[model samples]
Target: MLRYSNRSIFGIMEGATVFYTVESNNVTNLHQFNQELRNLFDRLRIRAASDGSSRKFAAGNSTGPYPATIYALMQCTPDLSKQDCDDCLVRVLGDIPITCYGKEGGSVVAPSCFLRYGISLFFEPTDDTLQSMGPPPQAVLPPESNGANATIINEKKRNASRIATIMVVAIISFLILIIYICIYLRVMRKPIGNSETTDVSSADSLQFDLGTIRVATNNFSDANKLGQGGFGAVYKGRLYNGQDVAVKRLSKNSEQGNTEFKNEVLLVAKLQHRNLVRLLGFCLEGSERILIYEFLPNKSLDYFIFDPTKRAQLDWARRYKIIVGIARGLLYLHQDSQLCIIHRDLKPSNVLLDAELNPKISDFGMASLFVLDQSQGNTRRIVGTYGYMAPEYASHGKFSVKTDVFSFGVLVLEIVSGQKNGRFQIGENTGHLLSYAWENWRKRTSSNIIDPIFKGGSTTEMLRCIHIGLLCVQENIADRPTMASAVLMLNTDSLTLPFPTRPGFFMNKFSESYKESSEFIQASANEASVTDPYPR
Candidate 1:
């Protein structure tokens, strides 16, 4: 509960009297002047509405003879309402300064009424009245009341101190609990032998804000969607500082897939090369696992080399650069880097191109890390793209650096012929690009193997790339040329090309299977189509 008090004073400065008097048209209109006077006093009633209080006020004036003037003012306590409002004002007005001996000036100011007058105009304009007030008289109390008030004030101070102390303790307790929970989760979440951090640069290097990532990809809108893969959809994003980025967000339901995710973050963090796609930063917030990479404008090699219209833009010169770029990238991954890495899913689709059509080996999702001295490894699951998989790797689950060489060989042939390795079909060849290329090479009609669209391209250069491709697709892993040697042979004119032997696991009956498979796919598609039958 709260209490309030108020007071006001009024006075006038005068010298001489004026002879003019205010004259209204009718005597009954005197109520109009009284209403205006009441309205003037109403302003003080609504003054303290903000503090949830009610008020009322009233006032009156009298003009005597001898060219005298009259002034009147009125106000009410803020804690009063409408009826109380008018009643309080009327009471104050009834006790006007009639008792004060009339001389030249006088004033009447109570808890409500406050008026003043003189012989001349005491205020600025005739229609306007001054709304000024003096400060209220300070409240004073008896000794006993003062003692009780001091005690109550002291009690309030003590209560405030106690509340502040409790609030501080509660805040500290909450922070400590949060720290402990974080530590427990960190310890329990990590897989055995996993490192706490992938980089030694700084603890905050990989940290990304939620708002920052949202703004980068335009809140992950459909327009910024790059592509979808096994992990999740990739988004093309732009940061606040205008840095273009590719964001890979992992799917939550992907169970045993994060093994490669962790491998890539740790491996790429330590290694840096122009051929390898750069990892700008990473994020692990709540359920979000995002890997931010430098944006590659040209997209994947398959997007262009396999496309009918886009493939036209890639002449022999551009295609050769892409092939050599991929070789250099693979060479760095296999031998130059500290970790001996084998990209298990090396294919045309996995090789991304930059602005100048330079190939950068990407998609380290199925990558395997080998020790420096280790040469090979075998996996039972055998996870890889069907056509690009080497014969030994696909059938026996044996893979090495040479496994990637086999895929590279298939990519080379596809680039030259403008066809997919798996889509090759004639009579029996269905899942065989090497067999088709080798058969065309042996028939002395290798010119038929050149892409019909590249009819204007040099046959000599085309034959050279085809020959190198055959060498890389040999049956034995040892027979395949290393990426470094392949790059050197392609670049140098002085090196004598070696004769390629019988190709790896070439099935003579592929042409027959190809025909059967095509018929089956066609039949399946027809069965799936909704066709309306008409009676003949």
Candidate 2:
């Protein structure tokens, strides 16, 4: 049996719920047990809040009496900040006097942290501990009945071993021959001049006839239109096999040539990750350049996150999940995938949500491919939404992985604040979101930038996200964390984050710069395309 208690203490944690339970059995030496428990709690608190540690969990034991040992464990969710975890444990430690005094075992549970202690061992031993215990003894077999029998057995074993070796060698040789033949055939079939031609030919199996797509999308009717972007319109289609797909029909006036479009389709089709939208097939017939993707039922993230009424549906937990998912997707594109890719345009509108609201990054029309070792690239024609592009990329035509990092930072701020980036207005103060966030962060009033709807949310987690966003949008390219580092930061609470510098294009400088560039381009080549007026 357990003695349970629930308390709502405003002083300890405002509007936070605390639950605790204690074993009914009383301890014989209450004083000794209490001292041991207190020591364990202190140690766990320190370990959980240690700098640069990814784990927020710790377990240990303390000797209590002649035969009694106190096994204690404490943990805070990976999302909580180090200071927040320490404070939470301190609060719970204070409650032991009221909840678990004189008890042999007890547990304290809170929203973001929990602790438990018992007289007996409750967790499995670590691998090192098991190794320290030594290996189990092996059973000894009885001596052989006779020397003659032993000799016969040895002879038979030798023959069996010889036969097994011969069979293994034969199998390996056959496999090698088959592999060599396959490689030779592949080399012979590969085209010599253009490797991209090979990529297109290999993707021929994924090509769909125009008639099939036309039938699936009901001849591109208005009712089947899902959304429209600079590239073209997206239509919901149902194939004859009862499979649903999202069809993207590229505009005839697209500047990308037929070969470049096909190459992009092939590259995108090869990318596979849970956080990335799957490319099913493509159609390149005559003037039509179409790509088909797995249809998502819940639509894009912008549908919910930007709508005031639907924004509430995404609480702090959901929003944090989306942010982490997007970071992971970017990490995969940048480092994990076989081909290094930079998502030139990453925004809420380009991120689709599945039935469970999990994020799947979509839209690769503006994506740039990089060699495995290459870190940066230069492009003359700039393409992406305003307020999301890094200052260097927008003004100087220099693009890199950090360019996407800046856009991701803008997206993170938008998700947390539930407001767009450009032209962000707070009461009478009208300015860019980056400048406003930087100002609030410098003044230690970061909470002012958070959405008011998150009244009961975990303030520490939200503030940490804002801090990470600032880190990503820093003006110095070297200061911006890579997507991998950003993901680690999102999941690790105890890590000591570096101080963020001033964000690029602060005070709405990007708008003016982009406008000037657009005007210049219009008068000269008329090639630049600014998809969205403001960040999505």
Candidate 3:
């Protein structure tokens, strides 16, 4: 049987659909069968609806003489609230009399809950269930003529056998655990590259021969070139195994030296997350330093957000997803990863998108590794793009996770407004993107900062993102939210955000200086940074 109700689950407003089935045969003893099934259902329901429990599934059998046993299972969708799960199961259970009462076997399936029962076992017993059953009833040996003495001797023998078996298993388990720990330590401590030199010969497994890369890129032909950055040019290449890869061939005279190149290879290879780009391998032959990465078909965020025609393709949903993705990626870098990394040069161009438009943070050349306990660092040379740079870092060379947070804020604003950070112009009014967003936000006209293309998008979500962006770009370093807090704000709608302070570098005071500085950096060979001027 099938039924539909005007009740919703999992955010779909269409309602819930339920399907049920029952065996043709009926139990001989309806009272006993009903009692057993009821007990089983109660047990399974409690298991699936228990508070603070991660498990949403339960299965077991009830003993009965009428049909020997009744195996049953209950399951609820993981996202459903405990109360919702109980209510759904209760409604489904109420349908038993009408659909499958006294039947030998039956099943009810719904979007949020499932119920199944049979005369025979239909599912594997889980470990918990097995443990609940305890060890199988010990084999009862027939009493010998010696009676009590034989019984005592047999019990002692069984005890000794059990103890010996347990000891053997314990020893084997300990040895296995030790072996695993040793293997883990060896892999964790494996040398990434030569500490004395930039050569990565120590990481033989991740080394790619120059000949292979040359063949893949067709001897560095211009046709395969993807784009040029501060470090070098990237090329689209096909390996011998039919896998497409992005090959980054470093420029010999580029600002990124052997140290930065080695750093990129080491950091990227060890780091792995869905939001971060995967580094496949690298080639270190002669003066050529090439790094291979998984090719992302959609290219970088800048390719779409900055282009008028392409920006149309990114609706509010995709834009919000990209913003959230970048936040999670930053959170992973700053906290979740083994090394607390600060990607000093985070910008739209460094945020690559895969075929599905999922954001993946890339380019670790300017990233810094920080100890878990370390909160900040200083450098004499201030690197990274101008508009995205935090006020403290740009002026005082003080950087921390907040530096990346500042850049993320700018990127979020850009995504929401579909405008670049350096110069934001709307009609006669013109200023930095941060200034524009803050001005409108302060005036309760935050909708003005949203892209006009998003005609019917969620205004509230866009405004919230803009608010988060402002919070990130606060002039005071301490005022900026950490990536973790930013991520929480983006995900949780109930979170009440604190009032934002003035953003760093607000207004056009530094507009001329920023432009001049950007131009100078672009012109000067030694001062040049990877801006990724062209779309990938």
Candidate 4:
């Protein structure tokens, strides 16, 4: 553990400000490249402030068989002690990118630590450095045994046992010290408050610093804003490595349970599928709770499917692919994933598309988990888009895998019709998409609800999807096909579909009087996001 005393020199250097940064541009050996840098850094860390006089520190990985050699040096003012010098260098190393990221040669000279590196040896050998550095291996030595090389001395066999003992003891001591240091750092940097983010540090390797995220997101400016969601807004970002990412920043005063939302998000992160959006990592600093995801260039499904000009881009092939892709994603969540997850909010806006137009299910803020044997659960709060909620769920606060299946059904209809279910235009009557679909199905004019522009595709396949969609939205829970069955039906052309009864949201306008306030939205016949007034 590092304990900087009050009397400790928290001082900076006034001289020796110049440092020669060295690295090789032609080095193609990745293993050797990284090893050289690490070896040099490790050596520097060991010698940092260790020589009593904090004036000079030097290290290099020039002895390895690899032709590419990496050299480095860090030094502070001679007045500072070893600890102060070490702390200063440590702080510099913390910001590796600012000092040296991809450059082959660079120098970072700060008041605390002066760092320098280059491809060539820039510093001459000094008597103190040569004496302090360890002894060089003998010219004659046996070939490596299990990656270990031994030098040939007059009493090689005699000193072998002693050397082995020394190595073992050093390794053990180093490991113990590392463990102690890790525990101390974890305790020091641990999140404050009741700690909904206690387990967050377990994935610290993937965690991005708050400062780094802010820089990548351009301080969450309006230009970088993707859009607002139930809890907050999503922003597009590009990391220092040129990797694109999506940042979801939750509203500070959001009414949703911060701890519960994070727990579910962490659970969903373990889920891996081509159709499901990848959760990169999260940040919890002060009042900020942000979830990072792999950036999707094409944005959400609603972005394309809901727009007049963009809707035309979704050819029949793409639309069908989206439908099947979403089905497979749900199948993985409900059955294939490590845990059974019910996506409480599976609307078009939450389904993101990669560059290839492939669908990936995103936004699990409303998702709930269940065990393999646990099929159904209830909640006092009904949270999900209105048009997609299953009858048994919105009214009674009960939900299951079938609830998601009901939602998937609505998504299919929306994709096929290019219209939202909540407020589909129907000759100025302002009817629900599900009701218009059912009326068309009953009147033997199923094609009426389909997007007219999406013609020349397989007529039979299109009708079959509508049939499956209707089956999914059936008022009876038992009547709705499971995701497994729905996928099978979508992939199989010969599968017969039973007649679909009235979908849950059909003629649901009268139920608005029973609406409860929601964190996402309020209720109205003209529009609805998380409103389901059913109270049967």
Candidate 5:
């Protein structure tokens, strides 16, 4: 009965606001506060996961410093069953710290659930709430017996005691049997390696044999190859059913290829959204590790947006759709997916275009998952392409949801200008796209950055997007808007945008240092860029 379309269904769910911190009191002992919050989330997770999970909602408070208690309320969408609700809510609530940790009051809203916590009450305490639910009922007690009835009761009681003793013995015997069975199974299963094979058992039904894929791509002939990246080559294929698919064959020589291959196979399998590339199946036999995806005939956004001839075909209307589509897709990854994932590598080439020109995010080899309430993560082994990497992530290896915002900002500017952000020039200004956009906006000549392909499109929209892109790339991570907010800024015209300060790598001219910092990222770059492309 559901007349669902990918774009339509995606539009409906992409707007869900996942996690947010309220702008209230800033707790001084952030570490202690976070510890208490995690304890509370675990409690709720268990309560929601158990039987009688219909309520799928609970509220409680945890003690911090004296007179400083954190009051929290968590609830999942009523329609979701117990397990799904528990999973969705716990994941959504865990990102609160990254969104707003020190704040006294904040809320996270998702399509499945909404969580709010602070030093105040956001919802009325229900006596029948989930936390109050308890164990099985007892049989009604009989009225007190006396005289002749007392004698009969004593006789019955003696018999009842005998039956109860037998029942207890039988229950204990069953428990022992169950325990022995569990131990035996545990020992038998302990030898499985904690690697891709173990993690992807759930994907067994979807795995395609190498021979099947070989036939589909005719042994991965060069002519069938779509494009090559740092990790592997993608080939276009057709199954026996006549369904088109994209096959990614990773190079064995690459050091991180196996890890990335396994990660994509596991991570992409759980994510189902309109803007994401669907993983039809995977092939992992012997040394070969291949991933299959829905074939996108139009190639990638970079193939067109950076090409002069193809650029003209994407007028402002189409460009704007691409921008919005990218935003919604990022929103799904950051807030709406099964896990809080940071797509460390986000660039034009990673965005593929379908026949309808709708964008589907691709290449998840560099992505990372953030545990509940964990905002930013550090990495000594820096990854992601240059030009789009956030300053914190690129330099010190700190990345969070805001990192994606910065990349999205770079993408917006690239889409609007139909030029690569790494080497962009406007008249006398020869610097990175961010510098050019900032200078033009400040000089009241922002229109100079707009692509000539859009002659009659709305100037206001283009200007607004440029403004948003700048906000995303601000040197200060806090200044960047969350994807939910970014989507609002793009779709809702009335929302006002804050002025962006000097972005990272801001410059007046094409200095050698600037060139080094703004080098165009080739498809062959590793997980992260170690230095400027044109290092002086």
Candidate 6:
């Protein structure tokens, strides 16, 4: 049996409470890449629901996420499904005092569920009650003595001085150890590929000559420029076969682009999916590296979703179709494809619509893939836009298939509301659109969450879609439904959906603070400032 202590530290110092888990088996579903574990947990927490029969988060051993043989136990209240468990956790994070406030070993037992962690060993029973290991051990000390031996005292003083000197050296060594630990943790917390690791993989592929691309793009003239990204600019060109293609030219100073280019070629070249953008070929000449892709007539999903005038062209019917199409595309990446990919930077900008209005998911430069059986992973650095990112992933560098689900949830909400989640503004409160929507949902006023553009559409369909979106953005990675379930929910009207508790990143105090700010007034006065928070 493991001997654990129950004694609390006596000091003003607060006990450290690390938000992490230790699996009995090393076989964690979370891959140690791109914060996949954090993303997966956020997705699961949000997708679980408590509605009768069809609760998104079932409590039975056989239910919940993955399989029981996997020891998959989600600890929400009995009344709450896995989904409810996730919602409460999301909210609880906000409730944790701005300044730390909690016992060394204590729990917050909500009416529906309980959140806990303790210093002492507790029994892992399937209930709320905890079985403490026992009382703490008492320390044994040297006995007191009379002043019968002044000589002994002098000898003891010399020994005491030596011991103090040794202790000081030990303390200095301990401090150094702590410093190293902190440095290691900080390094581990950074995103996987930073400037230091510039060389990604550069597997041999169908290469193009720089002279060939330069002639095709007319030496990359301004007229040839198609679009611009963080790494480089894209240019339009015609290949030898008279095929129209897009050429991405990396900037001379861009280290990230160089790494991404190599990574994309090595990973995406072998992947074949309808929704994924096709990489026809690439070029690698001295001081010149370019990627060639099949160019789509329409640019990206954001150009339509966020532009009011252009958005009008995408009527509810068309937008709805686009939303479902993207879901199908994601399903292909996550499940139905040859590789189980998690698009770390999924957003409107990453999605491209073809001339026929068919949606294709693009931008594999920041994507991560895992084995089909794996469910989650972690990262050191967190990328992606703020509003679209799930809380778990943003805060803890965890991600997985479920991480994509959280991004998809944000996408679904944006689609239905015709609002940019990253830049949504309501009345005086400024918060993530997902959180704003959640507040309205809890008040049974989700109808108000719909976009004014779709004022005359079907309320039932809109409501259902909103419900589904909320489910996608749940707090727990396990609670979020799979892409398979999301596709089914969107395609099938017969399926029932449970109430959504809330999405992640709902900072109540921050919203309140923004509501009372003068900057908000300035933003409110300018319609342009009322932009979507998401970087579409």
At residue 156, give the lDDT of candidate 4. Answer: 63
The clash count for each model shown is 10, 0, 0, 6, 7, 49
TM-score: the better of candidates 4 and 6: 4
Evaluate model 3: give its TM-score. Answer: 0.59
- Which 10 consecutive positions of candidate 5 have the poorest summed lDDT? 527-536
TM-score, every prediction: 0.57, 0.60, 0.59, 0.62, 0.60, 0.55
Per-residue lDDT of model 1, residues 1-536, tens digit only:
11122532212111111111222222233234433333433444344222343222222334323233344433344444545544544433332211222134444333322334333443322111222232334557777799888788668756765664576346434544554566577667656753333332232334455546775788889999999766678999876435688988766664334444454465565557888888776665566778788899999988987787899888888888888888888887777876566776777767898989888987654234443344677666665566676889878888778888888888888888887775455344344567778877888767766777778757887888899999998887888899989988888877888888777756454467654533332111111101011111
lDDT of 2: 0.74
For residues 20-68, write the lDDT of model 3, one tens digit per residue: 6799987888768877888778878888777764656677788656547
Can you write out model 4's per-residue Cα lDDT over 1-536, one digit (the tens) per residue? 11133565445433322222335453456446545665676577667577754444555434566565666666555556676676666655544433355555666554455666666765543433444344644465446642344434334654654664466346434544654576688788866774223364455434456766786799999999988755678899876545788998877874546565565556657779999999887776778878889999998899988898999999889999999999999998777875567777888988999999999988664334343345578777677766677888878989878899999998898998888876557454445677778878888988877787866656777888899999999888898888999999999878777778888756543345222212122232221122111101
Model 2 per-residue lDDT tens digits across residues 1-536: 01112664222322122456789988786546666777767776788766554656677777445258778777666656778778877766655644666778987766566678888876544432233223535534457656766677668756765664576346434544554565578678887874324255566646777866886899999999998777788999986435789999977876677676666677778789999999988888888888899999999888887787999889889999999999999888878876567777788888999999999998754333444345677777777776778889888988878888999999999999988775656666666788889988999999988887897767999999999999999999999999999999999999999999999877543556533443332121222222111100
lDDT (C-alpha, whole model) for all candidates: 0.60, 0.74, 0.74, 0.68, 0.71, 0.59
On TM-score, the candidate that comes out on top is 4
For candidate 6, the per-residue lDDT at 530 reads 7
Model 4 superposed RMSD (Cα): 14.8
Candidate 1 wrongly placed segments (more than 4 Å): 1-204, 256-263, 366-372, 425-431, 509-536
Model 3: weakest 10-residue lDDT segment is: 527-536
Pairs of residues at least 3 apart in sequence or in different chains that clash in candidate 3: none
Candidate 6 overall Cα lDDT vs. reference?
Answer: 0.59
